[model samples]
Each structure stands twice: as C-alpha cells, then as structure tokens.
Target: MVKRDGLKWWFTVAMVAACWRKGVAAEAQASAIWVMGDSLIDSGNNNFLNSWAKADYYPYGIDYYRGPSGRFTNARTFSDILGDWLEVAAPPPFSSPTTAGRRILGGVNYASAAGGILDETGQHYGARYSLNQQVVNFETTLGQLRAMMSPANVTQLLTNSIIIVGFGSNDYINNYLMPNLYASSRNYNPEAFANLLLNHYARQLQALYSLGLRKFFLAGVGPLGCIPNQLATGQAATGNCVETVNQIIGSFNDGLRRLVGQFNDGSHPGAMFVYGNTYGVFRDILNTPARYGFTVKDRACCGIGRNRGQITCLPLATPCFNRDQFVFWDAFHPTQAANVVLAQRAYSGSTTDVYPINVQQLAQMRL
Candidate 1:
C-alpha cells in the first residue's frame, strides 16, 4: 500500500506540472506578436543591414521615445501601435544583436525596409531581406524557441501567436513601375503582375504554416496612388490621384482576400488567415480626413518637391510642425497618428477594415 501511494503521489505531481506548463505556454502565446514584412512595419531591421532603404536618421524617430530607431516614419509603425493596444511589447527586430536568448520570448520583428514578396523586388534599394529570407530568419528564431520550451509548448505558442505578414508594395513601387530600372512592366500587365505576386505569396505563407504559425494577419497593399510618391509623378492632375495606380492595387487586394479564404477553408488545419483591408481603411481616412483628425491628405510632411514628395524626407530635413495633421509622413510611409488610426481599425474594427475577424479576435481564438 505504501509503494502504491508513492506511485500515485508521483503521478499527481507529474499531471500538475504538465498543467502548469500548458498554462505558461498559453500565456506566452496570448502575449506574443511576430511581425514580418516591408518598411510599413519595419521596427529596426534595416539599421543592421547595408541597405540604402534605411530610416536611421533625424526627424525619423523624432517623436518616438527611443529616437531614430531605423523606422521609416516620423514615429511608430502600424505594428507598434497595435502592440500597445494588445498589451504586448513591440517585437525587437530579428537582426538586432540583442534579440537573443530570453529576448525572443516576446517575439521578433523580421520586417525590413523596402523588403517585398519577391526576392528581387527591392534589389535597387540594396540588400533588403526578401520575404523568403525573413521566413528563413524566423526558422532560426523557431529553433531557438524549441530549445527553450517543450516541442508541444512551442507548437502551441506558435499556433496561438499573431503573425503579421505585410508586403508587395515594393514589388510594384520599386520593381514593376520602374520601367527604366526593371523589366517587370514589359513582362507582365497589372493582373499578371498581381497574379505573380499571389503565387509567390502563397508559397511564403505555406512556409510559415509548415513552421507552425497558425494565425496570420495578411495586410494588403494600400492605395499607392493617393500617397505623395505617385502624386508627385505628375501622372494625375491636381487634387486627383492616379486612378490607374489605385486600380492595379485593388486587383492585388481582391486576390489577397480570396487567398485568405482559401487558407481558412480547412486546408491548413486550425490556420486562420485574416485579411487586413489597409486600402479601405486608408481610403476612408483620406475621404473624410476630419473624421480621423487628419488635415493634410495630399502631401507628405517631410518630403521635397511638388506636394513635398519628389524625394523622401532628406536627412535632418525640417518636417512640418504639425505632423499629426498630415497623413503621409514621407514619400512612402504614414505618420504615427495615421498608424494609430490604422492599428485601431485593424484591432477591433468591423469587417470593412479586417475581414473574418480582427486582431483581438484572432488573439482570443482557441485555435
């Protein structure tokens, strides 16, 4: 009887320990947010890269508490704002030297400035990590995670964690559109180009899935024509954006929405791919700027030239005093204020902003 009782006690202890481990894994998943993409959400990966697509300069992080943290914006990116709302720390860039050991538990940001879905998309910018490379980096991070936690716990953590995959803008902005520098325009039309992107994107997402990421927020490309970059091109008349540019972007967004559906249609098993309607939310903000407290919708706050966008915010350039009122922060990115708006809408807004469910919902989901 004494031996039996001892065995029973050992069994009870083991069960309790298992439950505690599961509880800890759940907590980690609930708090982690892994960011991957282009400059739109790049925290600081470019700082460690030998790339011209860097924002490690004055007036870039002038508003951020850290100051000039390599973010290509006046302040926080969209992921930063969303992390605040979710009560999670903004994942440190994967390239940061400090992103090792325990620092990765919160998560890691693999987004790189000018990075895109295609490996050669942002080659002009020099040495940006392509989406494939980012995924490979994540694999390295995953190997580290597995060492820290049991395989089961690590898988559970990944299944419950939120992964943001935002890319493709550079494929068009720097690749297809730059006819003199790239041959994509001569090779494919808008539909064909978008289809090409989707094909490559599908494979990339599958790679993440194979690595155990079950929840994703695929942010579609926003309206490029409305931004100062396209406006400064003189393709559209005053007070009017290049409609053709917006139309091409729309094709990509539409296909992306369908791709999200396909991913969730019992194909990946417990995988939830949420489509973030960035174009819709941004357009809404532009259509009724006062509703979002934005006053300057046409020009960048720091760029140079017609509509202040001929060139991106030059080093130490004196930006607009009232930066909060402006939409575009430079030729390519949004202001912190605009990022806040986008993050809020993506966190809990209606289907118009985030389809299927929002980030909050995805975090709370059992799967």
Candidate 2:
C-alpha cells in the first residue's frame, strides 16, 4: 500500500513538471511582436500633433473597453488588437535576466497617422516623419528594449516579433488620388502611380527585413471607391462603389502579394507576410450593413447637415444618434464599431478576401 501511494505521488509531480516545462517553452515562443504603420494603425500618435487626421479625444474610444474614453493610448491602434490576444494566451515570462518579468506577451505599436513608406509621400501629407524615419523610431524602440535585457533577449525579440505593417491608404487618398482630383497633376495614370508607390513600399520592407524583422502582417488598401468621402465628394450614387479607384487598389495589392512571395522564397527562414484585406471586409459591411448593426453605411455619422454626405465631423458639426449603427465616423475614417469588425476578421483569419495568406498559416511558418 505504501509503495503504491509513493508511486502515485511521484507520477503527479512528474506530470506537473512536464506541464511547467511545456508552458515555459510556449512562453518563449511568443516573446514580443512589433507593429509599425500609418493612420490605420495609429491610435492617437498624431492626436498630440496639429493634423487633420487625428483621433485623440472623446467618442473615439467610447465604445472600447466598456465606454471608457481614455482606454486606447497613442500606440494602441488596430494592429495592437493582436497584442491583446497575445497578452491573454501567451505563457508566463521566462526566468532569464532579459525578460526581467516585463511580460513579453504583448507588442508595441509605433504607427503614426499620415505616415508613409516613401519620403516624398510623407512630404505630400506634410507629416513630421517618413517611413524611413518610422524605421528609425522602431530601431530606437528596439534599443530601449536592448537596454532592459541581454543580447539573448534581444535575439528572442527579433526572432519572435511579428511585425505588422498597415499602410497605403494615406498614400492613395491624401497624396495621389485626391491630389490628382484638384491639382494639375490630374494627368497622373493610376497604374504608373501604383507602381511608384509599390516600388517605395518594396524598399521599405527590404530595409525592415535587413534589420531582422521576419514575420509581417500587412493590411492592403481597402475599396477606396466605397468610402463615404469619395462617394460624397466624387458624386458617387448611393449603393454604388467606385470601380476605377478600386481597380487601382487591386493592382497595388497584387504587386504587394508578389513581393511577399519573393520574400518567403528568399533566404529568410520563418519570414512570412500576409495581407489584411480591408477592401473585402469593408465591402461585406457595405453590402449588408444591417448585419453589422450599421444603418448608415455610406454617410458620415458625426458630420452636420441632412445630406449627411456634405458635412465633416468636426467640433462644429452635430454628432450622430447611435455611433454603433454607422460605418463611417467622418468623411474619411471608419467608426470604432467598424474597426472592431475589421479587427475580428483580421484576427480570426476570415479576412482571406483581403489577405490570401491568413494569420494561422503565417503563424505556422518555420523560422
């Protein structure tokens, strides 16, 4: 009887030890992910700045974290939603000196509104920092991380970090398409414009790869034709999506996917890149706005006037009755509820309409 009891106790201890070891290994697998991109990922990084593309104050984060106004920081953009997932499921911190119990679960977001991959595009937006400058910012962020941990820890950060890049919208809207509508540069061809943009984007990605970034989640440009701003300003009819602008978006995404395939086939092991198809996601929402609890899919929720299309959602404008029922918050930006749906699609890998390579596939890639 005594021998049997001792054996049982030993087996329990062994199982517990094994479980702990497995837990530690899992934790080590997901050390830290880094996110860098443009306004789509910029929570409030530009809110402090004097810019038209800003979301620093009230009503923005109202629906987030149970109606809390100040829930999201400048770094907590849409891409950072993945960080929330990591925080909940990632294992406990490693016992190494590098981690220092700093909880390597969640990532840091350095996305800024109006940020672009090219310096010229940045100049067009009158932004303080370009994509290269944002890369510098990321380097600085990594330097800070290095100061907190050892070289091994730094390696863990580099190897495990899932870099997410969400851009191209600002370039299309503020720089190319919108400018062509009003300026003498209207002679610009969409195909040539897309090529110029993609060339710069390719260089930026290569720069990041050279700096040890392996994993990437890139959000492609959405259906620019369906945005409320375009519909209102460009005189698009109700229930109609702008086909010409969407064609340009499609071309850009195709080129981007090819570039990603090249990277995957190259020497970088475990390096994976996937697109976040905001276009398809938004299209679905526009097609069946009621499914997502949205009533006004083609109009601004916070702008003034009965047309709902002519007004801009500013301090002087009247706010909507139910923001949750609206897809767009202003002339250009999406509402918080729309962002939530987009985040869910991006996370659950249902955004195949936007990204051909889902998160699960990217996560399974061998480093």
Compare the candidates by TM-score and give the number of the best one: 1
Q: What is the total number of backbone clashes in candidate 1?
A: 0
| Candidate 2: tens digits of C-alpha lDDT, residues 253-348 | 777777676767765665777777777788888888766667888777765543355555554344676776777776667776676567656765
**Shift in Å, residue 193, candidate 2:** 1.4
Give lDDT: candidate 1, residue 149: 95
The parts of candidate 2 lying over 4 Å away from their true place are 1-29, 50-52, 65-77, 88-106, 122-125, 180-188, 237-239, 305-311, 316-318, 354-356, 364-366
Q: What lDDT, from 0 to 1, does candidate 2 have?
A: 0.61
lDDT of 2 at 263: 68
Candidate 1 lDDT, tens digit per residue, 155-182?
A: 8778778898899899889888899988
Per-residue lDDT, model 2, residue 116, is 69
TM-score of 2: 0.78
Candidate with best lDDT: 1
TM-score of each candidate structure, all chains considered together: 0.91, 0.78
Error of 2 at 195 (Å): 1.4
